[model samples]
Target: MMEVIPKQFWEGVEQFNSGQFYACHDTLEALWMEASEPDKTFYQGVLQIAVGLYHFGNQNWRGAAILLGEGNNRLRRYPEVYSGIDVDELLDKSLTVLKTIQMAKPEELALLKLGEDENLPLPKIVRSA
Candidate 1:
């Protein structure tokens, strides 16, 4: 069962889903700062994902690749559907983006489909009461 979602976390989710990666980073980072133990890892993972997207937005392929890889690794530790998030789907998307970058040569990175302006499909939060 899903627990009550915190206001800040919900806000972060909204920002993240709306492609406001920087805002998501800011919002989730605040939540992560006050979180503990397992939740801390969860929040950190989300925050890292946000920052990784932000880096992708800024055309920082290397930064995006590193952070996205690390973030997904942390998130994989959680249940497949923890806190209303479909971890499996999210992981798949992250992996797609990572592979796209990893497969490209530095100069050819611009030809990748996972660019900053790309309208990539993102995972949504399955909100629970």
Candidate 2:
């Protein structure tokens, strides 16, 4: 386990919360590259979800669903709170977003707005208090 969460992780979270999914992926990728085992998978999960959101914003429903499902599954092995993150909450929220994307028709996907849609608020990474 990592003794300390790198500054980059929080930076990535900030970017993610701000709807800067592409930047979040870049920020977390650096940390993910150096992580091992649990941490490696953890960071990858977060990164994947960020990219998934980016795909959703771009109206790539398939990419959004795949990454969101994969990412949520990856994080499922971890505790509700791991590395100071609320993994359970993240999973729940992302799953809702994923389902919305999965259920949308190809033509309807273009009309869906992430965070702006009443049903599809963008998932945010909540830090454990």
The root-mean-square deviation over C-alpha atoms between each candidate and the true structure, in angstroms, is 2.9, 1.1
Pull out the clashing pairs in model 1. Answer: none
Which tens-of-lDDT digit does each residue in 8-106 have in candidate 2?
999999999999999999999999998888899999999999999999888778899999999999999999899899999999989999988778887
lDDT of 1 by residue, 63-99 (tens): 9989998998999898877777777777777777777
Q: After superposition, how far is residue 81 of candidate 2 from its true place, in Å?
A: 0.3
Q: Looking at model 1, which ten-residue stretch has the lowest summed lDDT?
A: 120-129
Quote the lDDT for 61 in model 2: 83
